[model samples]
Target: MNMHNTSSPVTSKPEELVPSRYALKIGDIDVMVVSDGVLPLPTAMLAHNVDPSARAAWLKEMFLPPDAFDWALNAVVVRSGSQTILVDAGLGFDPDLHLPRAGQLIKRLEAAGIDLSSVTDVVLTHMHMDHVGGLLVDGVKERLRKDLRIHVAAAEVKFWDAPDFSHVSMPPGFPDALRSAAKRFVKEYGSQLRQFDEEHEVAPGVVVRRTGGHTPGHSVVRVASGGDRLMFAGDAVFAVGFEHPEWYNGFEHDPEEAARVRVQLFKELVETKGLLVATHLPFPSVGRVAADGDAFRWVPVFWDY
Candidate 1:
């Protein structure tokens, strides 16, 4: 499909003081990490399965607040050959939740010169509100091309039909919001969905594979070209995941399986030396992985000016 933008009016809002988008290349593919803003959530959400004291100790060691903190929300854009693929849509506005900082994907994308209509394909990591809500934003669908292909795991769609939340540990009202978002997403975009079984290539050198831990059909996108590699590892890995892969995030649907997936992905990154980017990591979260004894280490790349 030929991706082109329909002109939209430039608003009078002032430009942001700090940069919100980081661009890089994996050999031939063009990649841009865009900030959707931040989500101020409880620190306990990081590792609810572990003891509070242990979680507190880690927070202290990291110099973070013990009660709550902002989790960086990020999304990525990839251009390869003739296709422009959005890795995940950021959290759009949710009135019920008081997260005012998040849901900046659409504005950030426009700031980065990416139009909704220009996106040929959208590869969702899962049906989580944060990963697919941007498309649900006001008038977003109207601006998008009618033929826009949304590739999500078939397992994810089926699971949402009758999602299981007994294994999760989210705050009150979150589960309902998540379920509503997923249902609304499928209802609105059902016809455009291109459900994949395991893995599918969204564009040249861009492949998304189901990982199934955070959600039943959670997936990660891998971009490989020439000798370089990078993985947009949805929710499989987090900032704390490097040191304590076993600790379960409150958002995980299956904590045990999520931990296993995290460890496995870390090993793969270490062996292949591919760059890593995740949704909940700090903004512009592009880094590499290293083995720190039995645990893992995050080695962020030095920013290129």
Candidate 2:
């Protein structure tokens, strides 16, 4: 399978770095940011949590698409020695969903030299559709391997799997699906599924940071090798200028907290000068955060495939 170079600013397909796929090396670990598909929200839907005037002004300046915002779905796969770890599973090939660019993750993994059977662990930062949709495959359940262990934050588990989650005012048709998916995973993983708190080590050279607020337990991935670092900022920021440290999606479950978490994450990125990966910020979705005056901008790592 082939992928369009979502990271290419030149508007042409990029060269294949993994020979047959997409894999970037930081040091000892191989990081592959794979696509799940795209999720398009009507312009009206995005205006949910922000003031209409502010939203209007921002859209006009950015020259956004007609009547909608397209969010790219992606997940990161990390390989260390023989350990294969998947950051998040994307939306599987769901034909019913006409996301022109959706559901191609497993194929991308294959191109990157990763086999689903080889994945030992799957870490879910949250239960959002874009992040968790790839968990469930056709005949098999959400299990990556026969015994793949699924890891998630305890709060994340509680939020989606909770019986009373319906009481909360979420997007019109989302609460039901979220709850349904949570239950399905619970049944599939059984004892192989587990949960952690705020910060914990999910795998070698990987630390899970609980950067909540987007959802109850939204988290981010921090990876380090030979003292070099990379932060996989999940659904924390939108691609079109959400790089201003505090600029975050209004859909965030806890907007104020999301802003605080993004600022803190940006601070860490600045101090470390580490590579950064954003799930929704374009494709080949890895870049660096740099201070532009008081705000921040994403400097895409062009060298990465």
> Which number leads on lDDT?
1
- The CA lDDT at 7 in model 2 is 40
Rate residue 186 of model 2 by lDDT. Answer: 68
**Candidate 1: worst-modelled 10 consecutive residues by lDDT:** 1-10
For candidate 2, write residues 61-150 as lDDT tens digits: 778864677777778888766677889887664454466566667767765556678888888878766666666667545435677878
Highest TM-score against the true fold, candidate = 1
Full-model lDDT for every candidate: 0.92, 0.69
Query: What TM-score, computed on C-alpha atoms, does each candidate reach?
Result: 0.95, 0.83
TM-score for predicted model 2 compared with the true structure: 0.83
Model 2 stretches astray by more than 4 angstroms: 1-21, 44-47, 93-100, 163-171, 240-250
Q: Compose the digit string of candidate 1's lDDT tens values, residues 210-254.
A: 999999899999999999999999999989999999999999999
Clash pairs (backbone) in predicted model 2: 36-103, 37-102, 90-134
Model 1, which residues run further than 4 Å from truth? Answer: 1-14
